[model samples]
Each structure stands twice: as C-alpha cells, then as structure tokens.
Target: MNSWIKLSVCFGLCFSIAGCSSLSGMFGKDADYRKNEAELAKKLEMPPNFVLRRSGDPLVSMNVSTAQMLEEIDTIPSFRAEGIRIESNLVERWLVIEDLSVKDVWRGIEQFLASQGFKVEERRLDIGLLTTEYLARKEIAPVEQELTMISRLLNSWRDEMVDGIYDRYTVRVEEQASEVRVYFSHHMMTARATDTTTAWRLRPYQPMMESLALYRSMLYFGAQQDHALQQINTQRVYQEVKEADELVGLRLAATLNESWDYLLTMQYRANWQVERQQPEQHLLWVKIPQAATADQGFFSRLFGSIRTPGLVGIKLTPVSGSTAITELTLVVEEGNLNPKQRQQILTDLGLLTE
Candidate 1:
C-alpha cells in the first residue's frame, strides 16, 4: 500500500509539470515547493501531523497550475504528487460541505482553508470545504424562505443534471438573528432506479422517509417571530445575503455529476434536459455533452481526475436516473431583480441555470 501511494504520487508530480515545469529564467530552474516545505511551514505555521494518519494513495488532479495549487500542495502530506494550477477564477469560486464533526476531515479543511484564505464560516448545514478564492458575494431573504427555494431547486435538479442559484438565504449570527429557526417542506419527485448511490442521494436513503403528508394552515407573512432590527441596514444585509447564497451551487456541484455518472454506469441508463430563461439573471441547466463524455476504464480513470481539493464536483443524477438533469430551477431568494447582478453570478458559475 505504501509503495503504491509513493508511485502514484510520483507519477502525479510528473504530470503536474504541464502547467509550468522549468521556471528557468524566472527562478533559475532549481526552486521547488518540496525543498522549501520546511521554510514555508514556518512562515505559514503549518502543522506537520496532517498526513500522518493517511496510509493509502494520496489523491491528485489532472494538469494543475503550480502557483495556483502551491498553498494546498504544501500541506497535503508531501507524499509526492506533481503540482498543477487550478483555474484562478475556479479557485476563486470554491465550496465544500462535510458532516463537520470528523476531526481528521475538519483538520484538513481547516488547514487547507487557512492556506487559501477564503472567507469561510460554519453553519448547521452539512458541508466542509477549502477554497483558494475570494469571488463569492451573498444576499438573503430568511432562513425558512431559503429552505423553500432549496427544496424547489433540488426537485428541479433531478429533472436536469444542471444546477444553479441566482439568489440565496443564509443564517449566520451577522446574517440572521442570533436566534434562528428553519422550516422545511419537501416536494416529492420520483427517482427511477439509476444506481444505489443515486437512490441514496435523491431521497437520503441513509435516512429513510415515509411519505408523510403534512401541511401549514397559514400564509408566511414575513416575520412570524419578533425581534428588534438592531440598527440593521437592509441594503447591507441584503448584500451579505447575496454573497452567502452564491455558495450553494459550488458546494452542490460535485455531488450533482458524481451521483449521476456512478448511477448510470452501473446500468446502461442515463439522460435529462435544462432550460434557462436568461444567462445573467437565470439558471441554465446544461446537458452533459454525450460525445464529450467517456467511460472509465479502471480505478485510475475513475478517480484520477477527481483530485481537485477545492470544489469536488457535484454528484447529480444517479445511473438510476433514466435521464440527465435538465430542469434547472433558478430560485432567486433575493436580488435587485436587476438583470446584470443575476447574470454575473450565473455566468461565473457556468451553470446552464439561467
């Protein structure tokens, strides 16, 4: 196992050279992250016990940008993988969600997030991530209001493998009242047996549910609970909300595609479609190009290109899904209703959502 990891990492390092191999004139061709790990660690205050517990193949990516990936590359076990640069804009746009309690996972996330200096926060939602970005901006409506849109968006994602969000609802101490309450209402969607994981991802088979029909008797007339607005500038509050909501798409990206491909490959089934009303102000659900996609040969091809430490791609429609996810529901939780702001968010994420 140790030998195999060493080998994989070595090969990965070699491949990483595609971005920038010999910076001869730039730095005399001898400078490298590895030789400087100790000095870098002192400057970065990076802890050494990071990769101690891992005993298997250290994950890696395709051609990556060394300068772009250096911060993360430094802390990642130094187990030997070639460095490559990730798109800065993509680096600038990253998110991750995890169960959050796991120490190893949290530690890794913390270290990586710090190295990247992303504007990160912890919430009740099940996500953990490290990003080398500073591009996201958020706006909000209400926690309950946010949930409504998220539920609706999930429903639409099933129909279209595409995912997006033009607006957001988030609850943080600064964003929401110190006392927060969330209400969830699910919209039922049928999942064709695409794969075990797809079935699981669609409806949380990990936590089975009974189709219990429930209802609310009254309309949500804005603030149901009373609290002073603490000198809150609605405009500033609105801007923060928009920035926070922007993360939902990036966080959910990996799960969208991963879930779809894994499910379909298990069977010979896969298909979906998405339509966006506008590019800047809308979510465009794109079809994963059929000809451009390919089948994985072994564990290498299956997981090889998956080494992006930032936004692991979304696991979307499972093989169980007889079609691709095409119905992109752009839930604008809050916006100027001004077309430009909406368009920028969609365009940046490159979702077929609008």
Candidate 2:
C-alpha cells in the first residue's frame, strides 16, 4: 500500500466513535471541544510518583488517566502540580519542584518556552541555563470600566493605544538532591535610532517585569499544588514555646526548610520588605510597615514612603523529630511591647498562637 493510504487507515482505526473526543481535544477549536479540554485538564492531578507510559501513539490509547492525554490539552497554562511551589526572593519569584530531577525540569522549561512563543537564543543543558531572544510586547495599562457597554468599549480601545516594551530573560536552574530551583532575571530594552540604522539598547533593570515574567512562567509550568498542599496539614498557627529560659517566637507544623519558605512567603504576602536575611543563621531582618490609616487612600498607601516601619527580628529553630516541625521567634528591635502585647501583635498580623 501507498504511504498516504496506510497513514489514513491508521488514523481511521485509531479514532473510533468512543475515542473521537481524544482527537478533537487536540485539534478541534469549537467551543464544546475547548470546554471538554478544559474539563479534562482540571481533572488531571499528578501524584509524586507518577509515571508516564506511551505505547506506539498516545492519541490512540484508550486510557483516560494517561499523562499523554493531559499533555495534549491546549488550555491556558497553570502551575497546579502536586510538588511545585512558587517563592519570592529579594527581587524575583521562583519555582521549586520537589522530587523532580534537574533534567526533567529542564525539558519541561524548554517545552514551556516553546509553547509561550519564546525563541530560544541559547541552551546549555550541562549548566542548566537557557536564554531567550528579546521579545517586543505592548505595555497594557489598567483601565477602569463603567457599568455601561459603551464605556467598557471605550476603555478597551484606550488600552490598545498603550506604549510598547521589549524584554529579554535568562533562566538559571539549580539542582539540590532530587529537587530543582528555577530563577529568572529580566533585562529590558529600548528602541534607539541613529541616522543610519535602528537598534535596541539595554535599559535599566525593571524588577516588576522580572516578577511578572516569573508569575507568567508559573502558569506555564502548570503545576498547581494548592489543593494538595492545603490537605497536607503542614501549616499551622504560631505558638510561643519555652525552650529553657528563652521564649521562642513561634512554632510551625513544618520542617526547617518548609518553615523558612513559609516565613518568606508570609512576609511577601504581608508586603514586609526584607532588610537582611541570613539563612545559614536562620535569621531575617524585615521592615514591617504599620497599617494604613483610614485617611490614607490607595494611591497614597501605594506611593508614600513608610513613615513608621518597624524592624522585626525573626529566628527559626528546628525541633528534632521524625515529623518536621520548627520553632519561630519574633522580636521588635525599636518598639516597646510587653510580652502580652507582642503576642497580640503577632496574632493580629495573622500569626496565630495556639
């Protein structure tokens, strides 16, 4: 038989009436088809020891639980994996995939970049470094929309007239044991023209863009662990424990590393700026700003300088046990607070004591 005839026969045999949605989930753009794909994507949750198997072609497989089936979905990217986590550093947000090898994450990143329309400028798998070509994208301004349709239409058009910006990024992947940490750095560029030619010049660094790209990449990683993480009971209210004569600041129902990450995440969520952090010594110095007064509007609260930011001292100590738990201690260096009031402050800031 001819090659075309044999291929056609194979496809016809693979896509039977019972398995037609599998094919349409990939190529079909209709509303119902896309909805089906989104539904399938939502049902996918990878266990920590998940395995992928492919015999011949995955599209022809009848198993609904196959990893290949989930990979075929073309929905918007997300980071909903079981062991994936997003962390904020001094200037950037990063991804930490637990129990995954560096090689596995490297491939996932390459696939993610290709799916996001990024052209790979360079790649060194040995060094776990990837660089992408500069991409030009329009800067969109946030538009406030009125209730009326005409008002919303005008605002939408106004958003289109916003300025353009270019960004280039470098990603570094570091492997620790069975886990990998991915960090991103963004470099901005501006258009420059002389009498002869137009070129792009590197602009000053924009930390905001670095954060934005990191978040967008998190979506591309599609490893959301929110539900599973919540079910793990690894988070807990802070507690004051007496270790000998010293009163420990807090205690957590997590390991030492988990406690550190949780503390950093909590600080980031609370908008507390880190002044100094020493992981080796388990100490962090952060500027905790006072709450905005009722008179301070949104713009003022966002743009104004911190008038009475307090310098807080945080320390962590791991308790010895099979189950991971850590002791956290908090102290105010420049404020006057009694023990009762200090506990109250931590409680008011969502650091509950049990």
Candidate 3:
C-alpha cells in the first residue's frame, strides 16, 4: 500500500508540471501569433482612392491623409475576441468595437443601462443615438474623522436628509466600415442654494464618470475585467493647438483636401445636418440641433422650451505656401450662440481648438 501511494504522488506531480509547461507554451505562442499577424496587416495597404461604404449608406471616397488612412488600416487586424478597445484624442474618448454589429452593440448598451437603473428617454437607431433620463443619486458628504459632539449630531441629522446630484448621458453609436464606434457625452445637474430656494444648475462635463461608463460597457460586451481596466487606464495624448476662447477656428496638420474629408466625416459622426456644401471652395453649412446646444435637463425639456436649431458655416482654407496644413474656421449664420454654446458645438464635432 505504501509503494502504491508513493507512485501515485509522483505521477500527480509530473502531470502538474506538464500542465503548467503546456499552458506557458500556449500563451507564448499566442503572443507571437498576434505579433506576426499585426506585422502582416501593416504590410497590407489600401490605395489612397479606395472607396468605403457603411452599411446601408452610399459609398464614400477615401480622400483622407496618408497617415490617417494607414492608421485606420493597421487597426483592422488587432481586434481581440471581445472586439473592443478605446480610441481617444485630446478632447474625448470613444470605444471602437469591431466584432459586433450596430444592433448587437445597441442591445448591449440597453442592457448595461438597465442594469444600472437608468431609463432610455430617447432613442434614434437610424442616427445611432440614445439619451438617458436624468438619474438622481444621493451624494453623501464625508464626515470628519475627529468630529466634535455637536458636529457628529449635525452629520447624523444631515445623513437622514436627501441631497442628490443628477446625471444624463447621451450615447452615440456610429457604424463605419467594419467597426462600430461608441461616443459618450455627460450632462450633470447639481443643487445650488439661492436666496429663496434651491435650483439645479448645469455642471461641467464629468470625464471620470464618462470613463467609468465606458469601462462598464466594455465589461458588458464580454471584455475581460483586467483587460478592460487596462484599456480604460491607457489614454492617448495629443498635441495641443491654441485657439480663441470661443473656438472660432483651428489648424490641422493636413492639406485642404484632407481637411475637407476629415470635416465631412466629423459632420456625419456628430449627426450635424448639412444644409449645403461647396466642395469647390471647401465649405459646408451645418445646423446644430437644439438638444445638443442647450444641454437641458429632463424637466426643462418637459416644459416645452426647446429652442430652434442653429446654423453655422464651416470653411477650410490651405495655409499659405504649405500644402500639408489647413485652417478651419466657423462662422455663426443663424441663431445667436454664446461662447459656451459655440464651444459645446465644437466639442461635439471633436474639434477642440482651444
């Protein structure tokens, strides 16, 4: 019996070692396989004039810059099993999922919001937009560690009262080629004490909250927890370009033609209604929606005070003596927009000039 037990223990130890070795070998091969695939994908390049079309959309010519074109091509083969990753610039961050269709991604988003107790207030699948109703959550102020008796009593009483902050999120999902991009915009309202009564005032964009939302959505889409967290923490940095306080104009490191293509793509992604365009002069006139500009809460919109949309002219001109640079300028055509409103529009268009 003792000889039999010793032989069994020796066999178990050998099997465990073999299993570990096999797993290590498999992981190493996977890493190398991915590396080789990426190299091969980079070797494959698309022609400058290659036309691409979105599902159910007209074929769009590829007039983008060489760098942008190559960047897009390189990302085609790097999709993991979950097919999700983060893409960001200096102004904003968005998720790019390659493995899922628009409908599947939309369904996943709905499920995620429902799990978080948020109701969809507005949905336009044709335009790939979803707006959530204002979700009010209590904000508990932190109590002092070494509080006096009076302070402790006050803290206890305040804890019993309800003080809340409200957040409304707008998610835009755009399908381009083989990838579906998801953009998240946050609007917040906080309680402000006035002389007569408390009012809810609009707060600035909460980027961390937006990041948290993206992280959760990635998890919902079957991304591994560690991978999702790593992707969320890895933010891309871009060079800063200075502009006016109101973001009237900005410069791009591309030719006039490239700039035109870039802005046209931006208009589509932002859902900007293009009233007219002059490709000969590289000019476009677009209308900005009221809901985007006003940033009103649910109650404010319920009162039926929505404003008319604003029209703006976008003009692109080449920098003097430089074929590789272009300057973009915005001119308000129709409604009176404040600096804040103009900035908001620019941000929505992903043009953070300031």
Would you list the C-alpha lDDT of every candidate in the order shown?
A: 0.28, 0.62, 0.71
Error of 2 at 235 (Å): 14
TM-score for each of the candidates = 0.17, 0.40, 0.44
Candidate 3 ranges beyond 4 A from true positions? 1-81, 149-162, 193-196, 238-354
Arranged by lDDT, best first: 3, 2, 1
RMSD of 2: 18.7
Better of 2 and 3 by lDDT: 3
Give the CA lDDT, 0 to 100, for residue 251 in model 2: 64
C-alpha lDDT (0 to 100) for residue 228 of candidate 2: 31
What number of backbone clashes does candidate 2 have, counting pairs of residues 3 or more apart or in separate chains?
10
lDDT of 1 by residue, 1-354 (tens): 999999999999886784364564266654565767766665663233343322332432344445656766654442111111111111111111122223433343334334333334443334322223222223342333446776866665434332211111121111122211122122122222444643312211100010010011001111111211211111010011134444232222223344233323321212222322233322324343222123212222333553212111222222234333222222433232233333333332233122
Task: For candidate 3, write residues 254-344 as lDDT tens digits.
Answer: 7777778778876765666898998998989997665444544432333345454457788888879989878777676545544555555
Model 2 stretches astray by more than 4 angstroms:
1-81, 88-93, 139-164, 192-200, 225-354
- Candidate order, TM-score descending: 3, 2, 1
lDDT leader: 3
Q: Return the lDDT, model 1, position 228.
A: 11
